[model samples]
Target: MSRVSILALALGLAASSLALTASAATPSANTPSAAITAAIADVNRPQADRDRDGDRKPAEMLAFAGVKPGDKVVDFMPGAGYFTRLFAKAVGPKGRVYTLLPGELATRSQKAVDGQKALAQDKAYGNIVPLVQPVNAPVFPEKVDVVWTSQNYHDLHDAFLGPADVAAVNKAIFDALKPGGVYIVLDHAGDKGSGLRDTETLHRIDPETVKKEVEAAGFVLDGEDDALRNSADNHSLKVFDPSLRGHTDQFVFKFRKPK
Candidate 1:
């Protein structure tokens, strides 16, 4: 063959090899990593929890948050230990998961405390540590990779929880995470411009408000996933309005502490 013909043949072979390698590394159709999928499929997960998988979308959320095996995680105010269980599994044997409950609630709500304690004691959830702390402090035993809270950020302003200092809470969360760690907040969305007005009543907050306050803590707005979003929500009714209880307009925001 001529020199030019030989070079063309070599380049084509190299390109073909690279394509095969790339395809091998990529998961198909958004499936999570094998470790994550294994955690989600663990037979030990509570049957009730498994039933809710359709709506909670645990695998999608974990995948988006970049939760990997052996990454320390904190489930902030993990009521009833729903996500807490999943975190424990995702972190696996080498890692740990902490369930931090608002101190007041831990002391006052026996049921909530009991549920978390039970999970912590379960052999299958050996990686979990249950803690009680004031709403104002996002205390953790050590800096962790991810701090996750679902459907509860707005409660910081509730008369029952705070009028808690949300800014201080955000700062505490920032301090508790290692550099480049993730903070995942999932909550119901209020009407545009609603601000904190509807937090206590409607149990929702404007997504913009949440973004601005969290950004002020010096963390970067990494990305947002709208997998849980529901445009059908009118945003006027309370989250428990019954009409829209199970399906509310929600947002999943992922923020990163700069490395």
Candidate 2:
């Protein structure tokens, strides 16, 4: 063959090899990595009802937060370390999970103190770190990939935090997230126009109010998941009341810091 003909033949062979390699590199859904399977299994472990039951957030919510095996995560007011333990395992050893304890209440509340002690003793949670801060202060070391708060937003309006303090807390959350980082909030839903009244009596807040306050802190409303929706909830019962404890109408919202 002529020199040009030989060169053309070599190029054709290289292209075919490249195509074959690319096809082989694609990952399949069922192809479980040993590390990921182990992490998921740990998350599925059976535990006491108090620690495990309340931690049963919808799987979709975890996906929406973009939680991976090695991303830094912060669980705000991780009262009892329920979600904190899950996050610690989900992130694996390569990732870190910071359980932000409400500083003002941590030392004063017996429950918070006991929870912290228990979490510290768990060998499976070596990746977890406890951060103590005032209810309105965000004392995380730096911005993280995800900041998760569950059923605690209404407490922001409680006498302890109040409106002004809550706004500061919101701003702190915004600052604690990296650009494009996610803030996942799950809270009980109050009456549509009840404003902040439900916060005091029912320990709930209107969804609209949550959206407005979070948006005011410079986060964009990314999306919401209805996985926890319950049409049977009348939105008038207190979240801690026996009637609503496990069945409150809850809203799940995802907000993102702008890149």
Tens digit per residue, CA lDDT, model 1, 1-259: 9999999999999999999999998875436777678888988988988888888888889888888889999898888777888888888899999888888777778998898899899998899998888888756789999999999999888876857888899999999999999999999999889898999889999999999999999889998888889988889898998788868989999999999
Error of 1 at 7 (Å): 12
Report every candidate's CA lDDT. Answer: 0.88, 0.78
| Pairs of colliding residues, candidate 1 | 103-133
Clash totals for all models, in order?
A: 1, 1
Clashing pairs in 2: 103-133
Compute the lDDT for candidate 2: 0.78
lDDT by residue (tens digit), candidate 2, 197-241: 888787889999999999999999998887678899998677788
Residue 161 in model 1: shift from native, Å?
Answer: 0.7
TM-score of each: 0.89, 0.80
Error of 1 at 77 (Å): 1.0
**TM-score for predicted model 2 compared with the true structure:** 0.80
